[model samples]
Target: MLALGLNQFRKEHFWLYHVKPTDPTTYAAVGVILLSIALLPCYLPARRATNVDPMTVPRHE
Candidate 1:
């Protein structure tokens, strides 16, 4: 919805040179890239935490 609104605003006031603001392929690619960027850091820490022994965690605390 935001993209659509932005595209509308752009269409009314600005000229996009050879760009398609409402392209589905561009949207999907950007969505996937953003999702991967967001999830990678979270996944790495969770994966590392899972590898640690449960018995050792309380000893440190």
Candidate 2:
């Protein structure tokens, strides 16, 4: 992703984001957004998995 971003954008870009430059807030926000996007979907399945009774899971013969 770092390499992809670097290749996608030019250095010293006028926008808030630039390939060569590093911004803590930018990275933090990006991390949070991506994490939310990713983890939100799995929350339901994760919760359900935790609630499942192992003994009730049917065993294949």
Best by lDDT: 1
The lDDT per prediction is 0.82, 0.69
Model 1, 1-61: lDDT tens digits are 7878778766744335655777777789989999999999999999999999999999999
Q: Candidate 2 lDDT, tens digit per residue, 7-54?
A: 446654635544235556666787899999999899988998998777
Candidate 1 colliding pairs: none
Candidate 1: C-alpha lDDT: 0.82
* TM-score of every model versus the real structure: 0.77, 0.53
Top-scoring candidate (TM-score): 1
What ranges in model 2 sit over 4 Å off? 1-13, 16-21, 59-61
Poorest 10 consecutive residues of model 1 by lDDT? Answer: 10-19
